[model samples]
Target chain A: MRIAAQAVLYAAFVAVIGYFSTSPAYVHLAPGEAVVKLSLSHAGERKEPCRTRSEAELAKLAPNMRSPTVCTRERVPVRIVVAIDGTTIFDVVAQPTGLAKDGASTVYRRLTVAAGRHRIRAELADAPGGRMTYSATTEVDLAPGRLLVIDFAPEAGGFVFRS
Target chain B: MRAALAASLDACEAAFDRAFGQAGNPWRHLGSLAFLLVVVTTATGIVVYAVYDTSVGGAYRSVRAMSAGPPAGLALARSVHRYASDALVLTMIAHLAREWLRGHAAGFRWFSWLSGVPLVALVYASGIGGYWLPFDRLAQLSLTATTEWLDALPLFGEPLARNFVSPASVPDRLLSLLVFLHIGIPLALLAFIGVHLLRLTRPRSFPPATIAAATCAALVVLALMHPARALAEADFGSEPMTVAFDWPYLFIHALQYRTSPQLLWAAAGAAGLVLAVLPWIERTPHAPAACVDLANCNGCGRCFADCPYAAITLVARSDGRHLPRQAEVDPRRCASCGICAGACPSSTPFRSGSDLATGIDLPQAPIRALRASLDRALETLAPRPAIVVFGCASGVEVASVREPGTAPIELVCIAMLPPSFVEYALRAGADGVMVSGCREGDCAYRLGHEILRARLEGSREPRLRARVSRARVRTFWGARADARSLSAAVAAFRRDLAASPRAAGPSMPPKRREALDA
Candidate 1:
């Protein structure tokens, strides 16, 4: 009788392990849909351009940090917006990823849409201005289960779309 | 609410104890069982780790082929790693909860408890790293979610989530870093485990063979029943319709997506803070440490040998007297349980009350006071067949065994009752003596049961006198819930005492009472 009970307990223990080891599927996106992922990791242009400091200004600084060319590591926050078929699908004002605002401003947002051909428009603004720094408008046919990756690479021109 | 939880834990333990018996009870061996699972996990992982390709493009294919087995041993090996790892994490959590609930996080255990806070994080880091080696859709999701969560903190100047943005952005060398991290972090965890066990003397690091075998068998059966297979190969540009998540390791990923990473970090930080400071929340109740009497100590080194904590050490006797060595207590590590006093030969109750000093003893519960308590208890023990019970505070309720013509003398632990005390009670007019304590492997003072056992069996110092009738003595080691078994043992001892022709040891000395009163 004790053996029977132990067997039962052993079975229950294994069942729990089996159930939790891998189960309860996580659905990331709805069926018959494609994703338009706006992925950006770019350092924004400086809020203010570098300026040559006066000799007095340089002398006032600590000996280790003092320099004639005063270029701040802090960069301007970047604002980005992406629209698909004239509908604004993704929009964000992303701050640089550091405590001192001295690093690249990154944006990784996914927009789910129906699988079809659509006109995509993307824009980026590096400074606090109505003027745009980079913009691209393109037409791409996106199939279901495929990702339309909208990425930023200054060397390859801004807002390159990879489908 | 805590009391309710404790009572429920007790109930569950009692139920399991009956089914598995004391030796096989998982509740009794939670810490050791977790260690066994760790060993199992490492063994299986070494096999799979040696065989699997650690490249991003090749890892998923290799793991998938390993799972869809032509070689059953390799397939089983991979499955066992996953299963054993899952079991390892769950068992560790269970072990932590049991220790916390039992109020083991406070007092001398402060260091052990505080060091364990990082162990929880290490377990997650190690387990999540294990999943990433497969490079399946689940691994993709885990890696991406983990990086995004980590990105919320400013530790990295640039966001880490950029690596998961597109398939092109993820470098081939990234898998190498992940492999290095998976191996390196667990080695750090192993070092921390060493630190955790440092304070404990004679640490029980392995479960009994029966438990180890059963645990392995259970995992093997689980692996056979449901072989662990990888999800479809990862594509950063795509997501699987639904991915099967390893809930043990990937639950954090689930929670991160469900809530903001900042909120999750806040919760984790709050929990870590609470756990780190939990030891100081309550003060140690039994605070009086053991002290040594230089004059009475012959420096036999018995107390030093019997100390469960490495608290007592032998040093050259400070006084110019020609003693070989003397016991010194480091009060910080001393438990003040009086097991050391029990092992001290000078702790014999036969000492006169005017100068009842032992070599080493708890100032709070001196063996002299125990002798006085014995005297008072024995004087009142009514009826012809009086039985005196010796038990411990941390064991069964000693007072609960009190009955007609029966009385109990409680000590801090059963080992605190010197073997001479049994003979003293027998000579002082008690018909029989019964020594009881915590169950065999569940000693509150760790070595109390073993020390007392050897002493009574005449195998250790201050041995029970052979002239004392063995039939008139009884010993029962029972769990706290085993009061019924204790009562039954007492009843049987009473019957045996009645059957025997009242062979009481030599009569008490006539002038001993005057010396005791003086």
Candidate 2:
């Protein structure tokens, strides 16, 4: 009889834990909408003026430290602006990678957007004059639960869209 | 201060044992239960992993879909997985505390204790990794706090905390890494558990069926009642306010709110070092391991089968003998409880001969010497109805049981007494025998008291004979500090023997004694 009671109690305990663990009150959420992924990689060539060292200046420096020509190695930061339906959604100054800040600047992002027909505009500038070094305007039809990718190809000289 | 702390912990353990130490109780199998819980957690975790989404954007949504719109059992699986993980930590802590309180954490037992320290850290790491699988508010909070902690170290070139600055900064590949760690840490933990039990000849890897069942049932009930669910979707741009925490595995994160991360790491590291070196800190003297006498061995393999530590093995005898096998003792694994000697049939005190030796015996205190001691103890007794008190060296000091007509005998462990020795004592004119050892769930030699109890109750082999009077034998269990209580128990047993009607003559019939002597 004592064993039977323990069995009953054990069964009840198991039942209680099982009931609570899978209690069917969890909220059901909708599936995520379409996403727009952007990938950009650009590096502007250094345009700083170079000067040749005079023999007198070279003689004043340490023998190992002498250089014939010197120019600024600082890279121009890539400025990008992304717009959807005439409204700017992304604006950033992407700096180059590496310790000397003279490498290519890269950008990767995924943005969620509602399914619809939309006009997309993107611009990038590599110099300090604020002139658009690269720009594109395109029409896109997005479907629910789909992905739209926008990428940059320097050889193509502009942005490319793939679905 | 350390001595006081150890005493306080011992007192607490004694109180806990008093409350829960019943025969066939689950509390007695905490280590086994912890292993069982780990198995349950792994099984349920596999089921959850089958449907889990690895991508950061889909991880949270996939969990929701699996929980609410599943093949129905996945929701239950997730809940069971979480609860079992929590239960595993709980049982592991209880098992560690029980071992510590029983004073079994040092000396020769240090290998098992030290191996267990890493197992705890691995369990915590694996459990926290599970939380990071679903990219929700809780995961973000865990990741933020963890990276912040790691940032305190000089090992990383860039602070890992920078990855959580925005959703754009974190990538889906990082979620994959979390999944890998979640799976990898447990595999490492399983390996450590194997190493921990390597020294023991026969480790109890799983608890008894009833205990395993009851523990599973309780976990299932908890899972069903309070199913684990992801909170709001993680927004790396926003601060996580009012994050819910699972205290068992995440209590350390709470310290982040009050103290510097470096200080928390220092405290945790110091605590871990203390636990790892505890065995060395408390160096109690242990009896040398038992040795096997090949000449006296009959090649029966009784000691090999009965050795609790699995330290004995039946090997083919190199020397020619009628019987094929002989027992070999492994010194590294032997606990030196002399249980193997007790199990040897040649250990019977009835075998009369000077310079007696058993097939397997302790080098420090051999069975022949034990017999001589028992004989001397019996000789010192006053008269018939005189009591023989058998006590363990690890338990209540037998010297404190100063009853008028009782003779006290100490053994490495009370289980070292062969059952026939009790009958021999009775036949030698003692009225009754009382045995005592470390309290239940507190045996210094792990299963010593349990094995003794089984032998006395006539359930296990080498059991006390049916011919022996049940009323003439009593067993009392208590710790070394419970010497006064043991004395009272011995006095009460003497009174009970005095009140009972005395046997007419010798305990064994004359005809039976004559046949046995032949």
Candidate 3:
């Protein structure tokens, strides 16, 4: 009788956990959508201007500490926009990665779109002004459930794409 | 002061044993139970890992989807994983506390205790890494506090807290590192567990099946009742209004809000150092390890198998004997419980030789001396139906049980008593044999009382013969504080013996029957 009671208790325990762990209902979505991923390794270089020291400013400096000029330590934020077939879908400004907020900026995003993209236009601005520092335009056909990637390479001096 | 504290702890442990019956008791096997819980946590963690997204941006969404979206079992599995981690910490603490309180944290037992200190740190690291995987508000708080703590050390050139300052600052690789640590530390913990059990002859890697099942069942019930869910997405710009802490593993993080992290680390480091060096702090002289008498040893390997500390090994005999091997003892590993002597077939008390010896025996208290003591105790008993009470020296003191017709004899541990001694005492005119040892699960030599009990119950090797009437024997477990109860047990045994029919009537030998009848 004791064994039977223990067995019943164990069975009840398993049942309750089993009931809570499994979903009785779920929604399954159709699978024809494609994803476009964009990644920026480093935002374009800073656009802050350097100022030359005046004669009086140089006179106050120590003999060993003299230098040409002083430049701003802040970095330009990277602003990016993505357009598919003349329709803009993604736009955001990504800040630099550091405790002082002066390091290089990086971005990674995934945008889901209907299959068979006609044309894709991407732009990025790393300066304080809203000027396109880099731009890429390409025409490509996207397959169902495919992933298209757009990444920036400083050495290449432009955006690169792979599908 | 230390002695007083130890005495009080022993008293408390004895009280606990009396309140809770020994058999199937979970507290008796906390270390094994903790190992079992780790297995449960790992099993559930593997399920959660299947749906985990390692990317920083998708990590939070994937977790939220798992707990709130489809595959309903996923959420429950996640909760089980969380609760089991908490349960594992709880059991590990209890196991540590029990060992400390019972005074098993020092001397030769120090290796097991010291190895466990690092295990606590590893479990904490693994648990916190699990929390960091979801990228929720709580995870963010945990990550921030952990980074702040890490930054206090001079090892890193850049403060790690910089990584979590903003979403852009945190990289997907950071999440990968967390996953790697969560998996890697536990594997390291598994290796440490192997080292922890290396000294023991037969370590119980897992608890009894029923206890394991019960622990899992309890974890499941907890998971169902209080399912774990991911909090809101971490917003770096916003200050955390509140953070729920799992106290078992996150109490140190909670301390970060009130005290300096350096102070917390200092206190924790000091405590860990003390725990690691406890064996040296409370050094006590242990009995000399057992020695093997190769002349009497036939190399049965029984002593080697029965050694609780794995101190004995069988080596090839050099004397050109028919038997292939002989027993050898490792002094450092042996606790000198003399259980090997009990397992020796030559340990039977029926030997008539003037100098009695066993194949393997403790030098301090050899089998011949023990047999001599037993014979003397039986010879001194009164003419009435007498009872021979066997007690452990480490347990209740035998000298205190002053029953008129009962003769008390003490051994290094009751486990050193060969089963045939009970029959020998009975045939030598004792009416009853009463054996006692340290309270259940509180054996001074780890498994002494357990092995003794199994032998008496006929389940283990060298069991008591069936001819020995079960009714003529009784076993009682008690501690130093249990003297009065032990006395009462002896008195009750006397009454039972008086009530039963005398065995010295017609079935006995004529001369021996005359001596008893007179």
Candidate 4:
């Protein structure tokens, strides 16, 4: 009788482990939903503008080591605002990477919405008063479970949408 | 409140003891059962890793291929590995709770208790690392959430999350490093396990055969029925959209997202701090440690062999005796349980005129005091068939079992009562002798009842003399909550002894008394 009880307990425990191992599927996304992950790294304009050095100041340096201009490696903190339709979903004043602060400012944020056509407007302000130095406004039709990304092209000086 | 809690735990243990019998009880052997689960995990893990691919692209491919067939076909090893790892977490937490609830983490046990604090995190880390190796959608969720969570701490200069921010950012070598972590963390787990068991003497590596077999069979059945499989492969641009999640290890990520990362960190930190400081908070006051007497010690080495904490060592003889070595007790490791006193061959009460000191003895509960207690207890019993009851203070409370014509002598632990005392009780006025301790496998000092039983059964040294009447001796066991059962057992033994006529008087066996005097 004891052996039977032990065996029944073993079976019950096994059933629990078996059912819960992979059941009640997790919903990472709702039906008819798509993801727009805004991922880009872009350094803002220099905090202080470069100026040409006078010969008198250059003379203080070693002869072979003199440069034409002096510019700070530190980049200005950039205020970014990304909107989907009319709703502002992401806003941050991103600091540049690295100790010298010359590295690119970056952001990776995901916005999940119902799959369809929608307006995505991303704006970055390098100067004061939220003035837009780089910006893009585009309409995209996304399939369910598809991922769309808004990235920055430094050379193009604007956001590039990819699906 | 604490007494109520301990009684509830004992009642639950008593229920299990009825079903499984004492030796095979799961609640009593939780530590060993957990260790056994660890072994099963490691064994099945080796089988799964044999076919696992470490590259990011190939990892999902390899796992999916393995999951293609019936459970017994190709997924056997993988399913078993996953289930065993999950079971390891369950057993480890149960072991921790059992020790903590029983107040087994104070005084001489502080070292073991303190060392085990970090093990909870280590076990989780090991399981989390296992989840990442599959490179499926669930693995991506685990890997990304973990990296982001760790980035909250200042140790890593670059955000670990940056590696998973985009498809181009995640390098193939990232999977390789994760595989390395999988190996390194479990090795650390093994090292910490060794440290955890260091203070214990002859620590049990596994549960008894019945439990081990039953647990293994259950894991196999679960694996065969469920047949663990990977979700769709991990991709950086898009996240997993409705995965079949393994909640055991992956629940951390769900929680990390539900409550903010800062809250989770605070909770985990608070829990760890409490566990680490609990031993000091409940520091039990120490009894005087056992001290060895070289004059009485014959270098027989029995006490050294019987010290449950490995506290006693055989040293070169310091006295004039011709014996090569004497027993020495390391006070720090000694728990003052007095089992060593019982293990001493010279612990015979017949040498009443002498100091009554044994080779090794607890200063708190010395042999001389015990002999005196026995003499006084028998005196209280009348001229009828008197009964002497020896009980462990940590086990059944003998005071509740005490009745007229019955003498109850409580010891620091059950094994502290020398087997010679049982024979001495029967010969010196008691019609029969009864001994009780913590229910089998639940010894407070871990080996008290086992060593005592061995001694009486003649399998161990300082055995009860063969001339001693076996019928006049009886042994019973119970938790402190089992006083009613203990009383019942004692009454039964009393009746059995009364049925067989035996005259009881305050008289000693003349021949044995003469032999000891000479």
The candidate maximizing DockQ is: 1
| DockQ scores of all models, one per candidate | 0.56, 0.06, 0.03, 0.48
Residues B1-518, candidate 1, lDDT per residue (tens digit)? Answer: 88788788878877887788865778778777877877788888888888778777888888998888743588999998898889888888888888887888888777878888888888789889999899988888888888878878867665687787778878888888998998898888888888887777777788878778888998898898899987888898775557887888888777876777888899889988988889888655757889998988878888888888788899998987898888898888888889889988898877655657888888888888888888888877877578999987887887888898788888988998889999989988888999999877677777788889999999988799898888878898876777788888888888777777574443766567677555
Order by TM-score, highest first: 1, 4, 3, 2
Q: Write the per-residue lDDT of candidate 3 for residues B1-518, one digit (tens) a residue.
A: 65776687666555444444455556678889889878888998999899899988888999999888543498888887887777788778878877887778876777888888899888999888888899887787788778878766654545566566555558768889899999999999888988888887678878877778777776777666667777788764333444555666767776764677788889889989998888888787876889888888999987887888888889989778898899988887788888899888899877666578789898999988887787777667885678888889888897888567788888888999999888878887788899999877767777888889989998876688988898889998877888998999988888888899565732334553354335
List, residue by residue over B1-518, the lDDT tens digit for candidate 2: 65676677667556545434434355567888889988999999998899888988888998887677543388888888888887787779878976886677887788899999999999999988988888887788788778878867755544576576566769868888999999999999999999999777567899877678777877766666667776789876545545566767776776754667889899989989999999988888766889888788987877776676677889888678878889988777788988888878788877656566888899988987887876777656875568899999998999888556788889988888889889888887788889998877556677778788889899976789998898889998888778988888877887888899466544554554454445
Ranking by DockQ: 1, 4, 2, 3
lDDT scores of the candidates, listed in order: 0.83, 0.77, 0.77, 0.82
Task: Report the lDDT tens digits of candidate 4 across residue range B1-518.
Answer: 87777778778788778778888888888878877877888888887788888888898888898898667855987888888877777777778887888997788888888888878888899889988888888888788789868866655535566677557778888778988888888888889989998878788888999899999988887888778977778887676778887777777777876776777888889999989998889988888899888878888998878888888888898887888999888887888998899999888897756457777788878898998888778657754567888999998899887778789999999999899899888777788888989889999999998999998899998798897778888888788778998889888887887799764443566754664446
TM-score (0 to 1) for chain B of model 4: 0.95
Stretches off by above 4 angstroms in model 4 are: A32-75, A97-116, A125-132, A142-148, A153-160, B1-6, B165-168, B294-300, B313-332, B502-518
Question: Residue B413 in candidate 1 has what lDDT?
Answer: 87
Worst 10 residues of 2 chain B by lDDT: B15-24
Best by lDDT: 1
Instruction: State which docking tier applies to candidate 3.
Output: incorrect
| lDDT value, residue B151 of candidate 4 | 63
